[model samples]
Target: NVTVIDAPGHRDFIKNMITGTSQADCAIFIIAAGTGEFEAGISKDGQTREHVLLAFTLGVKQFIVAINKMDTAKWSEARYKEIIKETSNFIKKVGYNPKEVPFVPISGFNGDNMLEETTNASWYKGWEKEVK
Candidate 1:
């Protein structure tokens, strides 16, 4: 049985986030790939970095990073790679093994790479196979 909890990412709801994460076996971190958005999220004051560190501290051992908003970035492979490189480094610092994490480029707005492979990201070999 799988229970999925949608924890709020806003800093104001960090207490609620912690409560939810404490019960999670895995975390699916959704980071935006839009121009400048990714940078802000990974910045020193970003909630992405904060939540990731919180999840790690609370012992959420498994992580799947979904780099969303690919449609905004026009599904560029370079943008995907850039987010992966920077995010991998951040997660590594938060105690996650970069090799063990599954990074999937997605577009929640367009429904790409959410449940199946997206032609938009042809350059992105599906991470699900590697994860399993």
Candidate 2:
């Protein structure tokens, strides 16, 4: 049996985020891949860093980072690489091995690489199969 707790990323609902994460064995961290949005998320005041720190502190170790909004980024491989490069150090600092973690590029709105392979991201091969 699997239970999914969709915790809110908003700073106002940090209590809810803690409650959800404490019960989770793993976290599927969805990071935006859009031009400016990605930077904003990893900024000093961003919720992304806070959420990751919270999950780690709450004893959740496993992470599958979904680089979402690839569609908005026009499915650019360079953008995907950029996100990975920028976030890898921070992820490692938060206690996850950068090599072990799967950074899958996805589009939540367009449904790319969610449950199936997306032609839009042909370069992002093997992750879907390996993850499953």
> Could you say which candidate leads in TM-score?
1
Candidate 1 ranges with C-alpha deviation above 4 Å: 128-132
lDDT of 1 by residue, 1-132 (tens): 999898999888888999999999999999999889899999999888988999999999998999999999999999999999999898888788888889898999989988878988778876653454
lDDT tens digits, residue span 1-132, model 2? 999999998888999999999999999899999888989989888888888899989999788889999999999999999999888888888887777778999999988888888999878865432332
User: Best candidate, lDDT-wise?
Assistant: 1
Can you list the residue pairs that collide in candidate 2? none
* TM-scores for candidates 1 onward, in order: 0.94, 0.92
Q: Residue 125 lDDT in model 1?
A: 73
lDDT values, one for every candidate: 0.89, 0.89
Name the lDDT value of residue 38 in candidate 2.
Answer: 87
Q: Looking at model 2, which ten-residue stretch has the lowest summed lDDT?
A: 123-132
